[model samples]
Target: MQTPPSRAPNADQIDLRQVFGTLRRYAPWLLLTPALAAGGAYLLSRQQPPVYEASASVIAVDNDAQNSLINNTLVTAPPLPQGAVEQVMHSRSVLNSVVGRLQKTDLDPALVRGIARDLTEELADNAFTRFKVRARLDPQQRGVYELRARAETPQAAQRLAEAGVESLIAWDNNRAKQGVIRSRQSLQEQLADLTARIAATPPSSLERQSLIAARGQVLQNLSQMAVLETAASGTLVLVAEPVAPRAPVSPRPLRNAALAGLLALFLSAAGALLSDSLRRRVNGPEDLLPLGLPLLGQLPLLRRKNLGQGFVAASHSGPLYESVGFLRINVQSLLQEGKHRRLVVSSAYPGEGKSSVTAALAESLGASGLRVLVVDADLRRPTQLKVWSPDRLATHPLPGTDPALPPATTVSEMFLRPEAAHATRVSPHVDLLPAGTPARGGLPGILNQATFRALLDRWAQGYDYVLIDSPPMLSLPDTLAVAPSTDGVLLVVEGAKTRLADVERTLENARVANVRVLGIVVNKLARVGSAYYSYGYGSEQASPPANPNLRATRV
Candidate 1:
């Protein structure tokens, strides 16, 4: 048989089947992780106390507006620089005033969110406080500031906002009065000096007259300064009064839970994909398609209840029966055109159920009315006898070959003395040659001898087909040694357990040994959906009679 060209590994290629298979395999974790995260977030959110917010808006008036409020002649303080309203609101002086006003209020302490012995100390030391300020420019190009405060109760939040507005207004008023107060003090001192000078000099003296006239002008200016001081008010004007909010602004449990769930879902999916990529296990038949080998059969994972009965007996009914029947048909079709009756069955690793698969295939082939012989080639670990029932062993032993030769009881003895070797019928049309005990350290040399091939050739004449149950290819060289004497090697791969790299390495080893690989048998595949393993007919349904038209025709 001409082997197909080997496929080069593509690093950038993505197999969607493998990706979906991995997700299906870990569906429970992917679903549970996000749900757990969302539930945790909601519970934590519920534990947090609600925070109520109230905001008050203050606008900065221009110098023109301030002058209109007071006398035009009065000197008003300079207009506040742009974007300085927030800084001034949060300034130590303004905040201290705010804290003092809050303390003098008759509000209950229990209503406040975080109250300390000293309100000033609490305001200064606490990194996260109830008070906050934001400044912005109004449409008129005037500076507007929004004073915001948060507390446990709506009434407390409103009180704090109102106190902030009152404090800022007081600070601005004091600032506006400073210039007028200083002017009045300077005028008063000049008037007092003029009176003292007039008393010391003669009434008719020119110097005294000049001083008297100057003192009258100072008196007039002082009177105007007095008026300005009483009329002057701060440039800051309260635009919007704070109101107690109906609802709290924070501790949104539903929104927080939703966000947390979405974040966790993304992370869990990424973790699953990364883990699957790193594991590199065979997920399905698509994983083996790159090897350029025909997939002869796929057996679903056996249920735990049916496992104790073993695969051979389990193959009599259920999905396993139909699957094994199909496998037997494929094997017969492949072997019909060529003289490939003798085949070695093995896997990449132990515990992959290669021995069970060999027994199952033998039983299936025998059911088709063909004589099948199962040879236990693994001398180190023989399992064919155990796989079959004890009563089935030596039920119909072959007659003695030559009267002069002693009959061989085991395969090891047959290699030593070929004339004595004989097969015992284990089932109808099925025989087993179990691997018997041999001297330690003597089996390897015995397998390598020419008599081993001669024994297989002689066995082929009596049986229609010989299935050699060999050891794992990667673990021991015994299978590789026995493979060359057979027609071809049948590789068994356990789905989701065997690594793809290990299977590739096994194929590479077979190539090096110059053994022809017939095909792959995917075993223990996970039963995912109804499409693959579940048949519409139940086990209790009557099986249709075998069709005579269905025959293993040669291609």
Candidate 2:
């Protein structure tokens, strides 16, 4: 029958309930990554160093000079005016001379050389890491050019700026002297040519006088030029001196710390997300697959030691018993359909808690005043009678000992024990059918064809639900022989522990045997305060921050 379609809720109209659902899904991830990033940023900010910067400037002037040695335009390039100051400030020639001066003056030669080399390297790196330097054109300032340097300490920064100024002056002085010598040599050559022209012939008085006066004027001009050169030579005026800086420019502690924290959080979040995505396995029933058919039941995880006792009635006060009762309720609810009044409990692999589920489920059903028959259909390992019977009959005599039975080692005789009571002695509401002693030959033909069918026919009307527990489908032919005769089969899945491929094969085997597969019962559902031996708190601990909106059934 078709149902009428309903109107969908608009996004803006969503209530707090829907918002909470979204939060629950992402809460675990939200808490993980940001924390990591913050920690990383904190460590980075704490480990950084503080820095200080100092600056000094110089001006290059080509003022009018009486002693113009070389044509100013020919000798000097357009003062990259800005670039030349910096080049002159830390020029190798200047630093080398300073190194030599420090040695001669008995100053710490090592210290001077070290400072020079260090400052040179520091300035070589771009401005962003060091100090910003600019050439401000100001006539009122000591020098029109500037040199700025930054270092680890205030003293170092100041010293660097001061040394750069001295070095630049020394370089300019040497350059000026070289210019003077070149000019002197050129003047001497021109004088010799004039002298030769005058001595080669009888020169008139006017011509001689004119030459002498011209020579004196030229000599006067040369002497004046020499005086100007001496005065103006090396001193680049100091416009501004080094003073304590107002703020330390380096190790922006707050900003650095913030950035470090952000980076740490980003990486941490990425890691957590990656791990969660890769690790999540379909572990629960609904998570495994949609419960399309009737959910025949689920069994709580059976502990290794619990295999010693079969009865897990609500009468037993321990948590083990409580969990068992819970399993019973779930099973009873699953059988509400009431199709064939009987169920075959089976697991894909051995030791998947099937036997315990069978016994507990039977106890649960029996408590409701409904007759529940528990049969041990596992021929290879008949555990029901051994677990349910105080006599320990299956272990002690092991069934095929009838003297009249005639050495029945095969499964048909061994699989049945006529001496056992139809009802369980320990559990009145539940009945047990032990796998009898080995009969003549083995299994497949004799046991499945005659012995099992007869037992089912005799017990058909005896109980409300005949819960036949069998061996794993892969373990033996016991389950196959019994599947066709049962109402439905309950496939048990161990969460996380059971692989998908194994479960698929188990389902395939049930289909091949023509069993009415009811549905799967996924066990070991995630729980709070539950611990396991193999998985530590890391693997087994339930991350409580799961979607608070969607919750699991408490029972």
TM-score of each: 0.61, 0.45
Q: 305 in model 1: Cα distance from truth in Å?
A: 3.9
Off by over 4 Å in 1: 1-269, 306-308, 337-340, 379-381, 390-392, 395-424, 436-449, 527-555
For residues 185-266, what per-residue lDDT tens digits would candidate 2 score against the true structure?
Answer: 6666666766766676466667776776666766765665565456445435566776656676776666765676577556
Tell me the lDDT of model 2 at 243: 61
TM-score of 2: 0.45
What range of 10 consecutive residues in model 2 has the weakest lDDT sum? 546-555
Colliding residue pairs in candidate 1: 408-420
Candidate 2 displacement at residue 255 in angstroms: 23
What RMSD value applies to candidate 1?
8.2
lDDT of 1 by residue, 1-555 (tens): 212212423659875666787788788998999899999999999999998999999887775644554447555556666656666665778777776777777678555324433345644675435667777876555778788988777887888889888988888888889988888898888888888988999989999889888988998998888888887777778999999999989899899999999999889989988987787887667677889888787777887778655556666667777666667877887788544388899999988888888888888888778889899888888888777754434533343345356667578877777667777666676788888763456675556667788767876775778999988999888888878887888889998778899999999999998988889888887653225346533252533332222221111
